[model samples]
Target chain A: MSTRHDIAAPPTEGGAAPGRPAPATGPTEADRRRRARLSRRWQRDLRWSPYAFVSPFFVLFLAFGLFPLIYTGWASLHQVELTAPTDMTWVGLRNYTRIFDDEFFWNAAKNTLMIGIISTVPQLLMAMGIAHILNYKLRASTFYRVVMLAPYATSIAAASLVFVLLFGRDYGMINWALDQVGIGKVDWQNDHWASKVAVSSIIIWRWTGYNALIYLAAMQAIPQDLYESAALDGASRWQQFLHVTLPSLRPTILFTAVVSTIGASQVFGEPLLFDANKGASGGAEHQFQTLGLYLYEQGWVNQHLGRASAIAWTMFLILIVIGIVNYVISRRLRASS
Target chain B: MTTTLTKPEDAAPPVRKSRKPRAARAGGHMHGGPIAYAILVLFSIGSLFPLVWTAIAASRDNNRLAQTPPPFWFGSNLFHNLDVAWTDANLGEAFVNTTFVAGVSALTIVFLSTIAGFAFAKLRFRGRGALMLLVIGTMMVPPQLSVIPLYMMVAKLDWTDQLQAVIFPSLVSAFGVFFMRQYLIQALPDELIEAARMDGASSWRVVWHIVFPAARPAMAVLGMLMFVQTWNDFLWPFLVLTQTGNPTVQVAVAGLGRGYTPDQSLIMAGALLGTLPLLLVFAIFGKQIVGGIMQGAVKG
Candidate 1:
């Protein structure tokens, strides 16, 4: 032991602290075995702990996310009712075929498209303008951002209800303001186009600031050096924005567009809570009904789970098609740029 | 555009360099113009006007709301209307139920996400890449696709109107995982973890002592964001929770909007009650949330 210490202690103490605390117990037989076991356990922990860390998310997601998605596809093939979800009879493509012929389904899809365009086009454009303004140096920027996000903080139910009061045909503050401004009073709920506009306005109010904030984030992420270099080259502010800011923000713009599109396609609460009498129908003539509301009406109101599943699947397919289209367009744009 | 230039240092040991704000940036010290302020003020007013109107409508009687011009100012009937709507719509119970659910969901999601995010950001493991891709892919799957089956599960398990109906499904968030992973990848230094390991710290010890402290700021931000999201979530809670039996704030407020009471003031009161909590949260945590969103957006 003394000879081994003479050989090992000098080397160990050379790079270590002036005096080693202790010998850390001699490398006796049991100690070596214990050290080996500890290393094995350490190696095992290193290799497997990551899986353990990530398993809960995977487990929950598989049960809640993936399984349900595939099951919805399965349930779409059978005749099932809400009253007895266990009961199933094979219907082949009857549900899909019926959805194709369903006039209300077509109308709902068309309204969804209309509202999506109405809300998204104006919203993104306004968001871009607002984000540009926000990116400028300002006092109390946080206050402005928080205030702008008020509508996002407001729940869809609450926002829709407040909007319903504001859009009242006879007594609404909006109509009164319009009258004061030399415009005639208009029926917002009863008129199909008016209802669509009002509903789209609610979406715009809720989301424009959020998208603006997102755009602002993207803009801020762009280094000021880019702008400085552009300025050195005598590029005007507009030119610099076009050349530097917009290009850097391409991915962010695409992200927001995809998110907003998904939101619009699955818009359920605004139209659901718009008019009480024609709640699920979206209006008296089902004019403002979206595919989401129509699905709810089919499954919950009419108790036809099978049909609703079909509708759900149809919406999924439509979203996939839209996603692919978006991808292709974005790719083409990227290549051209 | 400058990302390529900066990408090298990103993989280097943490620099601990703080990012300069836009005002401090050399070239662009210019403040906003008058037109910019005017537009921003206009937008802010537009953003806040509906909420203000809700209070005004709630404070006045139903008749006042149906008049030629809506009430533009507060009236004495605010508390009376609030009380009536509170009981009428079962909002008290809703507040309790929603708070508990949101709190539990936020806490669990934060905890789970941080660990998983650390794993993804720092650790080398099998299936990490594929798993992360799956998480991102899952974000694209709309809730409509899952709700039908979830509804079935809730019904079959006789969990209708229970908090777990909303809480369990919400315990996992793809965005939360992604957000935390992005934050940790930059926030945490590899040298720190290695030092801890050199000190004979186990992975568990490294997580508890090293990772958690480094991750605290992000954890707080994520928790608040998740709380707000779960609090405001409508579709699932509306389906499972009944208005009278058990309700979330969204469900209860919706019940009021469904014309349970024909009084418009009462409905406004409920809507105001439902939204006030979140607005207060936003008011207090506004800066942190703003920072968090910007941080998440950058390099995300």
Candidate 2:
């Protein structure tokens, strides 16, 4: 196997001394034979060391990563409870079929989709605009970047705690400001759409700056000549951004979209903490309950292990389908380009 | 997602027409305008105001916080509230527990990822491509899919409420391995490894003397990122660790706001205490963290 690289060729026995002088009587047959055996041992080390190096990660991944995934799928086909996770009865596809009739599941699914769009779309567009502005030679840009990233540094628990207080209907800062400006108070937690927007805003607030930095990285990496060429053609700044910058950033845009979608689907902590009094029920009427929260409610809160397993598999299946569609679209884009 | 080259490439640019007269027209006035600065200023406030207000709210009494037109300025009761949150919320223990868990996890992840990354980056091993693809695939397997079995194993091993329950599952990261592999492939030259080999350096010696030194910067950065991630991880920790007994920061903080009549200021204080350490981390090593994310984003 080490034959792939010419430079890794095994050394010949006794590989001539670099700066030391050899004895006039040279090497005895036994000395040369011993050196040849040492060379083979060294060659063996070279050949096998890479496997030794990489085994730890694969081993850990197998145990904690791969096995659990398959086990969850297997457990989904049975009826089990949190009281005794080991006690299982065969109920093939019942959990999956029950999901079809589960209204809470559908509500969570709808909320997940709406929240995903609300959170991801504006976050990315704002990120794109910010990244464009940041491409300008600015003063104290790192300071801006760091300050923008401060929200990201805040944990979900902490951020949600702060936001819940800020968005309180009666005594919150936003309502106070709105009242001062002659606007009526809005019940953020009780109102269905308002609650979802409030939840989505937390995600957007945390991630927009991060995605902006990513886009900024991509923008900085754009070859300057592309801009110059566009300018030579007398394109306006906005036009250059549309024609040149946007096209160059296609892959980065797709990348962020995929990441945000995955993140959006797994929206748990924000909604969970946003309604701290109600715990896993997202809201009083389950208005903003995402799939992730629903999974938690079924498994941990309600102790329906089999149902939770099914939800897990269902989420995985949805992600896989989306991934396949993404792959096809990207492939077509690549082909056409 | 792995197939996407969404990460910005940091490759060296080809030759440019540096002296061309037309270059000035393209980007000579690249500085932001007044309107741009205004927008940036507004965004910065939106980004930072909640954190600033958390401090204000933390310093006030519970009654003050529950009143309309919340205190915009600091209150004298900050230290008093912090003291209460510290003792009542068991944040002191949580801080230590979280530090140990995050530190051990980050170090293990960095060390293992570097060695494995070196293998994937340079070594000519059997099934290298397939194995690397497997590593990439592992990144997309959501934690929700895998937690039930991990929970079962933890319960079986009597690891519930133990730091090991949290630490064990986070010991290695696929992203760490991928990021390191990307770095070493470009940073560590093959010629150098070949020279070391020619000098009869054993595989271990080559890793120690050559690979690690080349990987020091990336290793440090990756350690910080992993630390932040593990520090902020909530769901799994919430499931396993009980707040009263062995809470991490998030669990402890989450516990603060519960019950029929909660102390509002005390909750804010706990939230502030839990968030301050990492914000300190961001304040200090932020630029490097920014660099790390962007660098890892491209190939990672």
Candidate 3:
């Protein structure tokens, strides 16, 4: 222990030497010349290496990312479809205008937002609570942590299909359980709100554990000393959790929230599978059609590529705004922390 | 002070006195505590119930599954459903095509991202920071925005319905590059590269010998993630691989539900088969996958 302590102490002293050079002992002429040469070489290498290391990303991005985004924006301005390619015409802002007037578009937007809020809030809260439990001294912590991530890893398409069976009205296990509890069977697919609820439940089920594990990791990083101090001061577990754990987890929470929002906004597979019986239009009335499904319907099903591209751009803009708002909030929270 | 108060239970337990107090406290906590556990267990069951149900339902005859208060237990029709799905959808072809597309796409993404990420993390050149910023910036833009243009491009190239359409467009993954860059930044120390250089190793040699070996774990994580993403992907595959014979797994499953009253057992069997590889991948690399996600979250 003494040897280890001795080894660590000299690093601080050595670091301080660079900060405060010994008087009249800074450098000899040879040392000065050698230092200057070394510094110039180091600067040159630093300048070259970073660019060399980072150029491939830029090259690929220019080709794939930037060009595609610009092209999408351009495509959105034109009136185009899959079949009538020869009838391409520029229709400025018409697609966007159509989206505002379209009831189906509005319904999709509403469903997307509704599902986003319904799934993300409960998912986050459950994650936080579960993480708190996991953070405590527990046996088989690693096993639980690994097990929790299973739903997230499961294929979305497969999970959605499974969920479709589970949410089936007559013979599904969910209804059977509900029947056992004296509740009547819900026509999960027939009702709009129930369908939305069922879809959101799938999202929450898959993601809650993943988010909880993340929160647990963040919780583990919080100093045990803080918890001890809180305990000594007569703070209950809940109180300490509220005051310390929540505040400490603010950034991670915000991150999950933003990601959840982005993910939710693009909710497609669940609703697609949920309404597959309705020709993948999300529902007969388009009740559960999210923005993502709307985009899919416009682009693929109706072959209205221009309008679909417009919706995609609109989604992108909304995501950017939400992301910026999230960034601002996260920064403020981090500053306070 | 805190240690002292909590230490009594650890040291010599004062038999009767300690037992009584501890048991009382434990009992009080337990009544309130099991609620959380109950809820969790319930949700866990709810979460896995569908998968379990699918397995059972897939094995049951149509008549059995269609019965009221559906049979929770398995029946002897697994092969029947499998045979139906296999012959009906020609899933054997779909599976091969899906595997080929996913495998090629994943390998391409790994190769491209690793090289690109190594360049981004280690090589110092002009516009390095700007390029990285640009790559990270693109991550926020949903892929939906570009699907139209991408569709147009594929159509113009006569690549629509071709495997290349699926494989090529997904080659440049921003998240993969970012992930690999982060991993490389930490794993590949400057000293190691400097040492390699000092020993007269060329730049390519330095990267291959010094950097690539250190990046295996990160590469594995990236590979697994890409594999799962590619395998499970529906939208792009559905759009691009529109040919009847070349349908991907998800596309094939979607097609299964499109015609006449869909065969529930057959569909479930197909879904289960489609998800099997993903489940296996997760089972094996669940820790690294979770770790990679958490690491990305922290860095972001």
DockQ winner between candidates 1 and 3: 1
Q: After superposition, how far is residue B250 of candidate 1 from its true place, in Å?
A: 0.7
lDDT of 3 at B25: 35
Top model number, lDDT: 1
| Of 1 and 2, the candidate ranking higher by DockQ | 1
Indicate the residue-level lDDT of B128 in model 3.
Answer: 68
For model 1, name the residue pairs that clash: none
- What are the clash counts of all predictions, listed in order? 0, 1, 15
| lDDT of model 2, residue B40 | 90
Using all chains and alpha carbons, the TM-scores for the candidates as numbered come to 0.93, 0.92, 0.84
lDDT of candidate 1 over A265-312, digit per residue (tens): 998999999997789999999989999999999999998888888999
lDDT of 3 by residue, A68-93 (tens): 77877787888899875435689999
What lDDT, from 0 to 1, does candidate 3 have?
Answer: 0.73
lDDT of 2 by residue, A139-233 (tens): 88778888888898899999999999999898899888988999889889989999998999999989989999889877766778888888899
Q: What is the interface RMSD of candidate 1, in Å?
A: 4.6
**Poorest 10 consecutive residues by lDDT, candidate 3 chain B:** B4-13
